[model samples]
Structure formats: C-alpha cells, structure tokens
Target: MLDRYGFEPAREAPDRVRLRNCPFHPLAAQAPDLVCGMNHAFLTGYLQGLRAPAVQAILAPSPGECCVELQDATEDGEGAAD
Candidate 1:
C-alpha cells in the first residue's frame, strides 16, 4: 500500500520503520495537516485491519522523508504519537 503511494522503506529497526519517497510531496507541503493526517490514518487502519494492534502508525513528517512511521506500541498502551 505504501508503495502505491510511492513510499519505500528507508530504515527498519526492531521497534520502528521509516519510509522515504513520499508521492504526496508538494501537496503535502501545502496542506500538511490534511495530508499527514490521512496518511497516518491509512497506515493505522491498515495495521488494525491486519490484526496487528501492537503496531501503530505515527505522523512524523520530515524533509525528504515519508510522512508516516510505524512503531511498536508502548507498554503503557499509548500507541500512535501525537
């Protein structure tokens, strides 16, 4: 799904994954809140649908990077970051 949006994994760790090549660029720059929010929701819903509640999607937009990140849920029960 991320590939469909022109995103590719740039880094991966035991607890995190970072993606690169955001196809939503330029537009994302114009409306970061909307774009990033949708991106986060898409990934989050995807994971939930796959029954992986322990993983969560976060909005951690950075220059030249994908707007979303997937990370392990905290033991305290906070999943996605704000």
Candidate 2:
C-alpha cells in the first residue's frame, strides 16, 4: 500500500522502515497534521486488517521523507513512542 501512496523505501533497519516520496505532496504541504494523521490511521488500519500485531505505523514526518514509518511494535502493543 505504500506504493499505492507513492512511497518508496528509503532505508531499512531492524526495527524501522523509512519511506520516501509523498503521493499527497501538495496537500500534505498545505496541512501536514491532517495529512499525516490520515496517513497514520490508514497504515494502522491496514496493518491491523492484515493481523500484523507485531508491526505498527508511526507518525515521524520529515522533509523529503515518508510521513509514516512501519516499526516493530513494543510488548505493550504500542510503538516505541509510548
């Protein structure tokens, strides 16, 4: 689904995956909070629907970087941020 959103993998690590290219560029530039939030929700739902309880979507937006990052979920079923 990242491809469908025009995001391509930029970096990969044991715990995280960074993606680049925003399909919603212009709109994201206009409202980062909204766009990023939606992106996060979409990814979260996607992962949940796939029954991937060990993975999660994180909102770690960066310029020229993916608005979301797929990361290993912590033991509490939450991402590292918690």
Candidate 3:
C-alpha cells in the first residue's frame, strides 16, 4: 500500500535509524519499504499482538520489512525521548 503510494524503505534498519530524525513512526525503521504515518502505534499494537501477519504481509512483501519493528519493548529505551 505504502510502496504503491510512493513509499520507500529506509536504507537503514530500525535500530540504526536515529530518533533525532523525527521519523513519522519508529516502525519506519522496520518497514522501511512501506509508507507509514504512524509507525510507533503500529509497533505498539504489534507488540500487544493486535497486528496480524496478514496485515504485515499486506503492508510489505519483504521478510526484512515484515518484522522491521521490534516485538520486544526491552530494545526500546536505548534512545527513548524525553
């Protein structure tokens, strides 16, 4: 959907994407290919087990992009914002 709408995957991984860049969503790091306006929410919901694999597949066709967002919250605080 996003790619069909002019969205491109980020060249960097989610962990590699810097927060200071003001990304629209943290999951933007994971689904670097899809155009997401709310990656943080997507990641949050996915973590809570609300987002389905079909939804992810519908969003991106690549395996790397499929699991772009981290499911574990433990990796979240490294660059948490104030």
Candidate 4:
C-alpha cells in the first residue's frame, strides 16, 4: 500500500527494517491484545479507522502484509527481545 501511496518505508536505527508513519500510535497502546488477539481483529479495526473514506481500501491484502510480518517477528521470539 505504501508503494501505491508513493511512500517508502522510513528506516529506523539498529534494524534496517522499514519504518512506517502511524499517526495512530495511541491506538496501539489501547490494543495490547491486537498482536495476540484472534485473527488480528484489533488491527483490522485500527486499519478500518485509518482508511475511513474508502473502506474497501482497508480490505486489500497489500496493507495486511505488515501485520503478517509482525506475526512472523513475534513468532521468531523477537517480541521478547530487548
């Protein structure tokens, strides 16, 4: 979706992983259960809020890739890493 939006990932320190702009960082704190919840419904809710004008945009799997990657990261035990 970032590519479609003409936005590239912003790199952060330590890890070369791409960073993303999330004005909704506050929601993440509210959804502590998001990453661990069933089917990532909390994240889906958070996304729905991000693309309110075009609800269909949130349905696209391209954006969901980030969530999938997050899942992999957590599964790899990175969730507990310092």
Candidate 5:
C-alpha cells in the first residue's frame, strides 16, 4: 500500500509510522524545507481524502530516512494543525 506512494513504511510504535525512503530525494536534498513542507501538506490531505482522519502526516526529519512520518492523531491530543 505504502509502496505505491513511494514510501517503505515501518512501524516504530503502535501510533507511529516511519518512512524509509524519499521519492523526491534529489529535490529534497536541494530544498529540504520546501520539499518537506509540501510532502507534509500532501500527506495530510491524502490521509484525509482516504477517510483516515485519525492518521496525521508530520514533518519529522531523521538522518538516513524520509522527512515525513504518519502518526495517529488520537495520541496526546497531537495531530496535524487544522
């Protein structure tokens, strides 16, 4: 499922999903802020469009991994800003 969106999803915890690779590596390398922000927005909308409103896309950059992560919005009252 995630593969189709260029993400190799990994579960770090019950409510957290990490991405192993970035499809827009070249562009991200050139402009991490711009690219990551766009990715976050896109993922957020994507999740909502899929009717998965509980899942939120966040920009959580990590070394050797994609900058975006998907987490359950039910945790700690944390979720994407509406």
Candidate 6:
C-alpha cells in the first residue's frame, strides 16, 4: 500500500513507524502546509479503512521524509516516548 505511494519505511519501532518519502514531493515542496495536511488525512483514512484503531497518524514533519507519521497509540497515544 505505502509502496504504491513511493513511501519507504525508514524506521520501525514497537510503537512508531517513520516514513522516508513523501508521495507529493514536488508539490509538497511548493506547499508544505497544504500537501502535508492532505498526506495526514490520507494516512488517517487508510488506517481507519484497515480497521486499525490503535494506530494514529499525525503531522510530525522532518527532513528527508513524509510529514505524517504512524504512532502506535495503544499506550496513552499522546506524547509518550518509545
């Protein structure tokens, strides 16, 4: 699924997954806020469609990667560190 969008799993921990690619690259470069928000929405919906309620997608933009990240919120879900 992520592969189709040019997303590569840069890192994966027990409670988080980091993406190394942004599908909307050139566009995102032009408009970070807009494209990043859409990316977040799409990932959120994707998780919901998969019936994965424990995982949540949020805007955690960083260099050389997608703006949205998947964090396993099973334990408190908020700012808890891995």
Clashing pairs in 3: 9-32, 9-33, 30-68
For model 3, where is the 10-residue window of minimal lDDT? 52-61
lDDT agreement with native, every candidate:
0.79, 0.79, 0.37, 0.34, 0.84, 0.82
Supply candidate 4's per-residue lDDT for 61: 23
**What lDDT, from 0 to 1, does candidate 5 have?**
0.84
Number of the top-ranking candidate, with lDDT as the measure:
5
Per-residue lDDT for 5-68 in model 1, tens only?
A: 6878655788888878677888888998888887888888898888887788887878888789
**lDDT (10s digit) by residue, model 4, range 1-82:** 5444422444333332332433233553466345324224544454456643222111112332332212222333434232
Q: Number of clashes in model 4?
A: 0
RMSDs, each prediction? 3.1, 3.2, 11.8, 12.6, 2.1, 3.8
For all predicted structures, in order, the TM-scores are 0.80, 0.82, 0.23, 0.25, 0.85, 0.85
Q: Which order, best to worst by TM-score?
A: 5, 6, 2, 1, 4, 3
Question: What lDDT, from 0 to 1, does candidate 4 have?
Answer: 0.34
Superposition TM-score, candidate 6 onto the true structure:
0.85
- What stretches of model 5 exceed 4 Å from their correct place? 79-82
Which of the predicted structures, 1 or 3, would earn the higher lDDT when compared with the native?
1
**RMSD (Cα, Å) of model 3:** 11.8
**Candidate 6 error regions (>4 Å):** 75-82
**Per-residue lDDT of 63 in model 3:** 35
lDDT for position 10 in model 4: 48
Pick by lDDT: 1 or 5, better one: 5
Q: Least lDDT summed over 10 consecutive residues: which range in candidate 1?
A: 73-82
